[model samples]
Target: MLLSCGQPLPLLRHTDVPPRVVENFILTGYRFPNYSLRECLLSAFRPTNETGNFWTHFLPFFIFLYYFVEVFGWEGAPHGDAQFFYPLWNYFIGVFCLLMASSMAHLLNSMSLVVREVCFFVDYGTISSYTVGSSLAYYYYIHPRAGTVETGGRNDSHMDLKPEHAGSLTSSYAILDFSVFFETFYIPSACVVAIICVLSCCNTRQRWRRHRYLIRTFVFLLPFLVSSTPIFYRLLTRSPYLSASSSFAASTSMSSFFYRHCLWLLMSAVFNISKFPERLAPGRFDIWGHSHQWFHCCTFLSILDELHMIKTEVRAILLSPTLLLPPAVLSRLPGPTVASTYGVMFLLQTTIISIIVWFSWHANSIHGPERDQLAKDHPKKPLKCH
Candidate 1:
């Protein structure tokens, strides 16, 4: 009954469209390909399988964007030098980009085979960039070495402290500092891993479409695990129940939130790979309650928890920089290096995906619908995702 531009744009059955757009266990509610851009945009409001997927992240995109403006207006300019907040800015941008890219991909990928391929690649690239952004924030804010800065004086209240006196807090008690070797290579290695994540995921999606669910899951999980190593180390080695210092107490609180985020991440991944409840009753969940929808919800929750944890960490550092941060690290806060590195990594991954998608578009264009028909006839088995 749905209409696009006053014409009825009916949903299709599984057989009505190409196999590439068909999700396992979902038999109806597919939009036809080659829809105009207007129709594709309007599809978000229709009762299609992808409508949930689109809104899950699209709605959160606005929420995250609002928070970014809120944080920038309320926290960044009024408190101290804006340069010190680059890590937070980078993290916020990553959340924004990933959510928006994912929502748009879901809504618009049905436009054509080429658009489908390109849109998902763009999604993968944004996810990879987000991992690097998380690492950038982690390196400066969450890593154990940077966790608890010892301010020599106990002012008891962070409210009374001045930004100019941040450098004077000179205590150095951390949960545990790693070898100098690890400290030097952490950020660089994370950037490398992010690049690998994109390459491996794109390759698997292109080459192993039939059984790529697990392979793709592994590809993305590796970077998340790698990026979260610092958080894991802190959780395993330190007890949050005991508060060692004011800064340590704040770090422990951040760890608690990290633990919650990890739980949400785990739930998201499980839903993504298992294809639960929906798989138990095919076609029943074509328009709702699908595993992919749950995955989006869990991941969005995880992002929210991460934002809160970072906010707490930022507050601690700003309130008593000298007490909570080391001189070497604190001195570098005013530079653009952290955000600049994130920019470079973001650009690198996006460039690689763009190249891959370009070749894909041309190949699909050359082969045209004949190749798609052949794909449908010999349809790859075990399609695991939506």
Candidate 2:
């Protein structure tokens, strides 16, 4: 049973392992594909069924990590406008952490039953981490709280300056009805939501296993919908003068960014739901260009698009950074801006990593139970390959 890593990999039939581990024909592959931790990392360098999945997000993770280091670890950071750079650093690190979490989930694919559960935990956790990253950028750079005269010391929505054609260098700013919401608006309690989501996805309950894909997708997107509710709502009630306003271009950019983000994100969901390209031509997609690959690709593109949007928003605010809050109010805006974001990202990532590690150490604990569950779920024997 203990095969040497140096030996040539064996071709595993669909029946070689539990049906749940490789549920569909596309998930089926040869033996020796499941290697030890050290070989698994090395296997990424060679071609395998999981190559595309592992590298798709893995490469993007490094790209984002480089940006994270450039923003915070470098000497120049913490030197200039600390206020601007600090929040930006927090945002970058949040993104980096989420990307890495996603990559690891993909990297550990087609692993043993116990290992797969740990990856499931990591994958589910990243859904929230990515949402937190997005919400961080939205809160800190996209739409911080600002008080207007009519609101009476209340600042929660994003305000756009309407540029009236007057013989003046400056135009008076008014709150746009299509106001963006604060980061803490619906995001403050996302941690609880995240915990729930992870549990729903990772639990070995029979009810959850019935409609697994739908359940996982809904749970994954729940956090995204919860955090992005403000943006979606603002778009619904957008204004006519929004284009001609000073923040028009930036607003347009942010809207475009959000659309792109949602588009790719939904594309990922579609690929997941439909199991496309592969479903059309079954065995052809076993190695690459499958739904999972497209999902990761779309996710990477969406994240990349947001990076540009973040830069545009930050630059726009730098022009009139103090317009929203006075000196007194500025001192108390840490929760939504940077501190809370940092805290949430760290908490989610650490807890998820801990769960993954624990599951791994006690892997044998779940093997028997999960295999038994799979046997009950699929009472018929696995079909023999022709």
RMSD of each candidate relative to the true structure:
7.0, 7.1
Worst ten-residue run, lDDT, model 1?
165-174
**Per-model TM-score versus the true fold:** 0.80, 0.73
Candidate 2 on 67-155: residue-level lDDT in tens? Answer: 44443343322344455555566556666656676667555644556666677666766666666766666655544423111322212
Candidate 1 TM-score, C-alpha based: 0.80
lDDT of 1 at 364: 72
- Clash totals, every prediction: 5, 1
Q: After TM-score superposition, what is the CA distance of residue 76 in candidate 2 from its true location, in Å?
A: 13
Q: Candidate 2, which segments miss by more than 4 Å at Cα?
A: 1-7, 31-34, 65-81, 109-111, 145-185, 204-207, 233-248, 323-338, 349-364, 368-386
Q: Write the per-residue lDDT of candidate 1 for residues 196-309, one digit (tens) a residue.
A: 777776666567777677776778777887788767665655422123345556555787788889899889889888998788999999998899999999999888888777
Report residue 329 deviation for candidate 2 (angstroms).
6.2
lDDT of 1 at 331: 31
